[model samples]
Target: MLVRPHRSRAVTAAVAAGAAALVGFSSPTATAAPVPGTTVATTTTAVAAPVTAQADILDRVRAVPGVTKVTEATAPEGYRFFLIDFTQYRDQRHPKEGTFTQRLSLLHKSDDRPMVMYTSGYGLSTRASRSEPTQIVDGNQLSMEYRFFNTSIPTTPDWDEELTIWQAATDQHRIIEAFKSIYTENWLTTGGSKGGMTATYHRRFYPKDVSGTIPYVAPNDVVDGQDVYDEFLANVGNDASCRDALTAVQRRALGTDRQWFLDRLAQLTKEEKLTWTITGGMEQAFEAAVVDYYFAFWQYSLQSDCADVPDAATATNEQLWEHLDAVAGMSFYADQTLSNYVPYYYQAAYQMGSPEPYEDRIADLLKYPGFNTAESFVPSALRPVVDDTKAMPDVDRWVRLRSTEMLYVYGSNDPWSAEPFTCGREASAERRECYRFYVDGGNHGAKIAQLPAPERTFATQKVLEWAGLTDADPVAKKVKKNGRWSTNNQLDRPEIRGRALGRR
Candidate 1:
């Protein structure tokens, strides 16, 4: 860690005021190499590093181990943004092995402020924004893209070996190690869906890296080889009205109204200009989308109210397709999407558990008997070997017996909530520093802010107490783009996105 003193209250207050009052924080009288493509109107004062200009601070950042490249962007109102490229070993166990670069973005509000490590399941995003945890506390955020994602890939990748949870957690460990030297303060981590799992994995391997973590809607399969999610969807909300309604739609599309929907699928292919060869032609994509409908319904909370369901038997082809498309996007099976998410499916097939079959309700409707949704995505070239019983169960064991200061959030109706992480039946008796909250009928997009009173207040209070903060005001108000807005980089924050959907 860099050897420097913590900024005084006066200095921190001055720095937060504006660039003009950035007294010792900016290098007013020093000469340092300027950063390329970096126009830093203000620089963060890492508690231990020399106070430098925004650009020089980045220059210093480049010197941090694992940080290969840094470039700044115009940030949201009161924040500064930068995209970073960090080098990682193919396997953390052997540094002598080959290396790869993983990409991450930073949104800095101040140096002394607590920082939230935001984990993203996708690499396509280059946006700078605050997370639900960050916004609640109005803190800085370091959003890192998962390894093997589009923006961060090893040149000669081996999906089977390099993408282990331990290695990925180490990828995060390296980042935390490097950045702590600068922003030396309490650190917290958070992610939703797969990203939430990613955060929990890091906490498992390197528990002390962050003060607390909130993993949202993250499923923890027992690794007993059971696809519990199927059971969850089967009885979600314990209300069959909507499930029956959706199943009726599925049956009509795949059973009675099959040919017409097939025609619509072809027409959609032409109109949307999508390719299906990756998933084996247009007809195959149709089958996948149709099967995906029921799962997607609860996964995404497609029906806000059960009364909205159109009677499948009486609904027109257009109505069926609209409802089908909303729940299971027709384009979800597109060539590019399938190709981009190859890593996601690979992870699922490997250490992460893949979904098990629960299609007895529509067994006769399926033409492809053993069509594997995640398996099909793993190209023969990747040498896929699925083991649903490896990674998560161990993580669960750890969370049950060892994890502390961890908060879990979920939607009661979100399909992945089937196996939400738990702290065992003795949670209160054990005095564990862990919490679990499920929105009444929330979906994958559930957030603590959306939770009812005291539970939400308690969750926020715990996170605040963890970060040692008292409030979350003064945060740049998250806003939506009405076309005229300059950017739409907001990641699934509830206030900005109507739905808190995470990665597909």
Candidate 2:
């Protein structure tokens, strides 16, 4: 069912003016009401702690895990480069103890080679702290660091106005501006998920920073983006086929106890279960498992409070995995944020307030206005404000930012498929000369790994080539439609290829 879209006059003006305020591009803040949930920085906290000297910044950055070295340069403008430890950021975000500050590492390489200034996706940590890696020519990795904005902003009119001011000041625009000051010349940039969204916005709002871009599974349509959020909710709303698929799994689990399921899985041979081949082998399986964990881990991770399986290990292993796939289409439990009805429930619920206004706006402005309609996928809680286009706009700005040189990748089975919905004609038409590849039976970003030896070499070589850097293979052929880009094996059928692309 579809709900009406809404726009907050105050929010619209605030965002527009806020965007304008970016590097003093547009007019100053308008007469619209001040944005809710923001606070101006008070003079009181000015002396919290002195920052490290500029000369020492690189040294501190190099110490982080995965960071091989840090380099500072004014080349390509004022930007610095750090060949980072991507593996490090992914692990550290889990956290064991102590307060952690988000950071990025800058790397250096031969100026003659094309460079990439990589940024990361959405998370509680700021860009400065996360160890985002930059893969340079000749297989060198550099990490980039940036700052964070953690001030709590009040969205409610009756809530604290000061906090909201704080958020508006340290808004995402400031984050981008701060990063821009570090680099001068054009470079290609990319990120996945939230990073993807940021990259999408960056390509449009700050085209000067990047020459071309890549956003893996970017949820550009954040307004209706999470329509597939909760499995329970999705089940209630799904059509018969979808409902039955999930119901089958539920019934299977009903009579079985958790321990019973675990024993069943333990008894299965590698060949019978096909778990080993699921991800090529056990070594690769570890990495794939982590990636798979992400879909639900976001909801339960330390950063947010959503839900926990409690006895996750105790759960019926095989049954649990099967159950996960069965109901996967229904759950939007991204790290416990919205999925769990919990202590932090108020925060998620509060975020819902921003979209409440959209529902009313959509009803008044569009043909399929009601929330109960078949076309409407708006969550019940979000139904009240479906029209708040101010919080989630149509992103026409994306058109101005599309690139022909871009390549998109996706796993066909990705849960986010229903929201961002990247594989559409509209997306294809929008970007000129863009190629989308579906990895047969591959998960998100899994195609490159699954490619046969030559294909893998070709794909890896293309990334280097795109960066204007050369490698040993220097693949000259385009990624062909037949999958047999090289003189190797015959490719699979289109449907098989597409289905294999995102089966994670």
Each model's Cα RMSD: 11.7, 16.7
- Candidate 1 residue spans exceeding 4 A from truth: 1-57, 271-273, 370-372, 386-388, 425-431, 470-504
Lowest summed lDDT across 10 adjacent residues in model 1 is found at 1-10
For model 2, the stretches where C-alpha displacement exceeds 4 angstroms are 1-102, 107-115, 124-133, 136-186, 220-247, 252-387, 390-393, 396-404, 418-433, 445-462, 470-504
TM-score of 1: 0.81
Q: Give me the overall lDDT of model 2.
A: 0.31
Best by TM-score: 1
Provide the lDDT at 316 for model 1.
Answer: 91
> Would you estimate the TM-scores of all the predictions?
0.81, 0.42
Which residue window of length 10 is worst by lDDT in model 2? Answer: 1-10
Highest-scoring model, lDDT? 1
Q: What is the lDDT of residue 224 in candidate 2?
A: 39
In angstroms, give how far residue 127 of model 2 lies from its true place. Answer: 13
